[model samples]
Target: MSKSVRLLNGSSLCSGRLEVKSDQTWSSVCEADFDQQDAEVVCRELGCGPPSVLQGALYGEGEAPMWTKEFQCGGHESALLDCRSSDSDRNTCSSGRAAGLTCSDPVRLVGGASRCAGRLEMKLGEWTPVDGYRWTLETAAVICEHLNCGSAVSVGKRKEASRRSVWSIESDCIQSGSLLRECATPDHGDSILNLACSVPNCRWRC
Candidate 1:
């Protein structure tokens, strides 16, 4: 069974090839051994949203040892390590058969022309716009990265005519690598953050 889990080789923290630690050694999971329930547990373990995509070699075939076991997740486990596993008889797995996953971000851009361009908002208990009072490109880049947008092209502010509720994110907290949900506090502000993200491969865009 896995003791710990992490993702590797994807564009953002929430997406990548799945790797699990066992016996103090990292091992890559085979696609045939993974399922949606298993993927759900991994995303939850990492504090990410639901799995959006699951495929083989979506990132890259990892160099780590094959897990050689099939995970049986109940879809409600808090961590991947809580799941049960059974040994697989198959010894050899093919290259490009490693399980890869991408989880949706808890944040999004809305009221714009494209998914990657608009007002910044995040889902806590409910969706709310972000207060962009003192935002910078660096902080905005974090949102872009999590959303799988290429990078931050520009950051702007949208002023509402009256004060409204918004999520006030502590820039310092975000710069320190905390997730946006962890860094936000409820506040009433008029200025909402506006951002435009570059479209790289645009694989995620609809």
Candidate 2:
């Protein structure tokens, strides 16, 4: 079995069901009581990248008590515990209703004119290009969505003239619900992924 890290219940240190501490006890957070700003603070506290996915019940509900106060973060707090709170308006929180969040793993698109278009790279211990093996629109969409660049518009393989070291992205693991960063492993490949995402203010090129 996996061990708990920090204040959240999750598989990785940065992705998991939202939980908070109050009065020397930890409790799960209700989805209604959490928001994007709250999520940002949690990610920052955990030393992860920006918030990627925020969904209720992405991780199983915990047996711990539910937090009774609503968080009020302004999106710039250094830590979740430092934010202000108010009496929770929620009367009850049922099972599978706890807030679950996935913080991004410092993934980015580069070498292109726009933030949404370029070769894919991820930062584990360091920034490394991603091997495009078995990469599809579905898998590429994960990166685009994490970057808040909307959906994936296109995915194509780019073969560099010279083979280089890269991180191999496991499509099966990702399709099975693992985050892209969690599924990446160090490997070498001849080709990398080129992606174009659809941003709200950009055309198909982005």
Candidate 3:
């Protein structure tokens, strides 16, 4: 059997048993209010699928510490034994805490260009310019996707009259498709100039 599962408050669950395979070692985990939700969290953290089973009392109660409680989870627990504060203390079963996640995938472009630059004229994807006319590294990366690029390496902002101007001077090694000289902006915001491979492309409204 493995060591007891210690809670954040230093309490331990020693009732039933949990079969866990870690480092090639098959050990038993103490069952408490632990449920499918907690199991799901464990699986996701370990890059596994969702948990479909929640055994209680270790099938017959193992040796040493015995579980004090059994919890019923919604199968969306964030961590092992992550239940409500009330249930966290009680030896009863209830729904567990759900895990929240945020992720981003890298985008791949077609052609290979070490650097590409364009003026900031519109917002797309997760990039939003500041003050309706400014661009930043974070915003530039979002714009790169529109050009089918990997990411933005550099960003330059220029202000002219009432229009706030921005420019991405470097493509950061994103592939370009057919040297897009002209691109129509999603809205009638501002006109932008795109330069690829040291050549200037047609200007379009973004």
Candidate 4:
């Protein structure tokens, strides 16, 4: 019998079984590609840590094939198994894509006791920090704007200093209407924060 389980519709292969340790406890596969250049793609898909150690047959081979050959992919590996296969290639196996993924910790948003001096820290997620900039008041305002929090009450620097920088802001306005502009500024150095916007209820950190 096939030890693998069939994923439901809208279920992702990354949501399927991943072999951690040496036993078969059904772990979620981290996104990491077999090839060096494509490893980051795996990290982006599983929503986990960064691809530090990429192992092909680390735990062991899977029970079945999750994907086809000709695995040309962008950095996004979430859609790896869903990609169309090469018709001309017949020697390939219909097994799962050979990958290993580890996402960096997520970015955490620490609410301030006073609401004006909140902070953001890197947590466990699929995001990374870029150099050359720090979060600012206008960035906080942008986050509030996306959340429909009216206007940003404050924005301040975080105490912890690392490759990743953090900042905090406050707002009461909630997103009710369509956004006039996606970001406060398009310039690279504008320092405007980008956040996901949801109608009715704003997901500030998203």
Over 31-128, each residue of candidate 2 has an lDDT whose tens digit, in order, gives: 88889999998887776778878999988888888887788999998878778988646669777889999877678899876899899988776788
lDDT of 3 by residue, 40-132 (tens): 555443333333334544244333232343445565655444544233444333222211211112122212343245433332233322232
Model 2, residue 87: displacement in angstroms? 21
Alpha-carbon deviation at 35 in model 4, angstroms: 2.8
Candidate whose TM-score is highest: 1
- Model 2 residue runs over 4 Å out of place are 1-17, 20-25, 28-47, 51-102, 201-206
- 51-165: candidate 4 lDDT, tens digit per residue: 4445544434465433323445565545334433346533443244434333332332335442222343332232222221454445455445423444655544322232333
TM-score of each: 0.66, 0.59, 0.24, 0.32
> Each candidate: what lDDT?
0.86, 0.80, 0.35, 0.35
Please give the ranking of all candidate structures by lDDT, highest first, separated by commas: 1, 2, 3, 4
**Tens digits of per-residue lDDT for model 1, 120-202:** 98876678899989988888888888778878999999889999999999989888876566788999998989999886866
TM-score head-to-head 3 vs 4, winner:
4
Ranked by TM-score, top first: 1, 2, 4, 3
Of the pair 2 and 4, which is ahead by TM-score? 2
True lDDT of residue 126, candidate 2: 77
Q: What range of 10 consecutive residues in model 1 has the weakest lDDT sum?
A: 197-206
Q: Residue 80 in candidate 3 has what lDDT?
A: 44
Q: Residue 196, candidate 2: how far off, in angstroms? A: 0.5
